[model samples]
Target: MSPTEPIYIADETVRALIDEQFPELAGRELGRRYTLEDQFAMRIGDDYGAIFPRLPGRDEHYARVVDLITPHVDRWTFPSSHPIATGVPGHGFPYHWTLVQWISASTAGFVPLHAESARPLGEALREVHTPSPADAPLNPRTGLGLPELEDQFSSLLAFACDRGAPENRSIDADAARAIYEEGEAASQDVSFTWTHGRLEPRAILSDQGAFAGILLWHNFGAGDPAADLGYAANLLSRDMHPHFWAGYGDVSEATAARARAFQVFAALRHIQIDDPFLMRMAWERLMELGLVHEA
Candidate 1:
């Protein structure tokens, strides 16, 4: 497959895999598609979801991490994906896949995890951000300190400024650079913990206007907790910051600054992907932070 082209797993291929490897689920209906980028995911009837990596080696880490985390989800005050089974690469699919118990909830992309749920989000973060074991996996993209990502961040910023931004919008490179520099400098005192790695709105589930569950665990690994904090910051309004901090406990000023930088990093990704819902949110965040403005 070409680098820019996403791998396509036809419905027929999925059915064949199910029939061959998980015969018990063979005749069941395939339901909603949950994701398509880093991996391909879809619901299997009413009870389960199937996840297949778009690239090689993605599902291996996911399976291992999920195994480690499954026991904790029961006490989290919210639902999470529960592993059911695993499948090897076959039926023309090149990567491993996993079957998990599907949790039904509206993605924050549709329902918006409002500030009213900030405390729950904070509490959830505190729970998941506990110290990771020494042998815990590390994700180079989303599971490292800000300083470790400076080169990648610089490249992303340059790309966004030079080519990624939409014709109707502009990214303030100077302001973005300043925020990143501050984040890097403030991130000197790094403390590692388990993080969701990618805590964007879409990965967050909401129900009845409250935080419900977190999905997309491929990015789960040991990293700076502030990275998740920064990603979660996108969902919070200025007034909601106090509520979030109240639940998550006090953080150093440096961590807060680094979180702000991570916030900008996520906004840049929104622009790159042109995801309308998240792009709007990211734009507002940039404007609020004085990093960008109207037109």
Candidate 2:
């Protein structure tokens, strides 16, 4: 399965499975090239829609996808024994099928099960961090090294910042320099190690000082949780909500400092990418948060 090669699950195959079990969508036109995030989608005439089944870990990872979509089908039914989207060889994860509804030529709706909406991060954290007896079940999962996780986090942060747009007002040179310096200092002190190869935070705070926290702890190991906190804070200052940071237990001075530092680091990431949207968004967030002031 080369990356360039298209992984196709034939329409007839999909239709056959649907017809045998869930006949309602049997005759509908389905798309063949759905991405990882675009698992179960339908195209009726010119309209496009998606459906998402509950994934195994990290409910917040799919929050944005769910937030933007609504249920379209009458009854929820599992479509096929196999996932509709196949994983490319180099790709790390498998793509699965979800239900989708086409509304019009340009619009569609997505349906997600309510069970996928929330997670239990706090309990998971306690379980993972607690010292277990020698005879206790030992999880055999491999963890990522600090350097590797940091590199990954840097890349992800840069990518997110590049995609984010700056606000209408521009940021001053002095303020920009300050943000860069601050982020660099913070990164040096932050750790990045995790049981999973990915570096993600359980919570995030937007520029408006709002918080968003995922209730599920996807994977665990030793790392600077502050780095993720910083990343989320940076995202929040970029106009994204901090709702993900909610219910993350008490906010500490360390968390607050890291959040501010990451906000700056996020701004620098946008600058590195030369992404006007993210830069502008970062600048606007700084202004709104009073991290920067115009001369």
Candidate 3:
């Protein structure tokens, strides 16, 4: 199906589902539906939301599924009236959803638009990382404690495992066990965790060297910065540019390590979700870059 078609279909589907599930929303008119290359979007009157059924390998992880839906709901709470809100949701589902809701409510009358007026990959990252008050309530799921991080990491890993790839249909009991154990080890290692305040963008300049809003994703909290960085780095390796990282702050060795680890985990997780496109792309890239070993 064409990208745009899905938006209309999904919008209709969501509207119908919502109407059936919650009749209070039945009379509300959902606005125009638009399709992007990877997602289906709709405007509920002036309210903006999206349906991302195309996200590669997403169906397998309930957390990821919730993550996708959370943003659409959060945006409804605070539509971006301002040219930019300076803070927007980033990576991971629950946290991103929670953060977006918090920022929207805190600002009250403000609407957070894409940074730099036009959305660019780099600027989007900067927006998420722009720090809020230090006393801001940390996401309960990703607070300072190691136990929480480990539990979340393991749960994500387990979810990934449950969504094993076609080749991994049998599910290797040993590998699953190892992942849990290693997840614990990684969480216990304080060096693996790096703390930041919020998501930030890596802006791309226009021909006049003016700020162009680009890549944005969350970049705060105490956890393996490398894991987060590595997740981004793999995306960069695929086609994302270094200019995006240029706007990011210093990258420590520890951060790089964490990023690398996260990259592999993300790859596996994506594969588990049966996202043929992402899986094929990741495997091909790994082979091309000599990152994967042939047995």
The full ranking of all candidates by lDDT, starting with the best, is 1, 3, 2
Q: Which tens-of-lDDT digit does each residue in 3-101 have in candidate 3? A: 333222335555654455445446566655434333333333333233333334322322232332333333322122211112112222211111111
TM-score of each: 0.89, 0.36, 0.42
Off by over 4 Å in 3: 1-42, 45-47, 50-123, 130-225, 238-241, 293-295
RMSD of each: 2.5, 11.5, 12.0
lDDT of 2 by residue, 162-191 (tens): 444333333444454454445444434423
Every candidate's lDDT: 0.77, 0.35, 0.36
lDDT of 3: 0.36
Q: Which structure among the candidates has the greatest TM-score?
A: 1
Ranking of predictions according to TM-score:
1, 3, 2
Model 1 Cα shift for residue 244 (angstroms): 1.7
Residue 52 local lDDT, model 3: 31
Clashes in model 1: which pairs? none
> Which is superior by TM-score, 1 or 2?
1
Which 10 residues in a row give candidate 3 its minimum summed lDDT? 100-109
Backbone collisions counted per model: 0, 27, 34
What does the lDDT read for residue 70 in candidate 2?
Answer: 23
Candidate 1 lDDT, 1-295, residue by residue in tens: 5765668889899889988999989889998666655777888889888888876546567557666666567666656764556777888887777887788888788888777799888888888888877887775445767777788788778767675334466678888889888988884465678778778878888896688878777666787788889988888766788898988998899988888888888777765664688877777776677766445
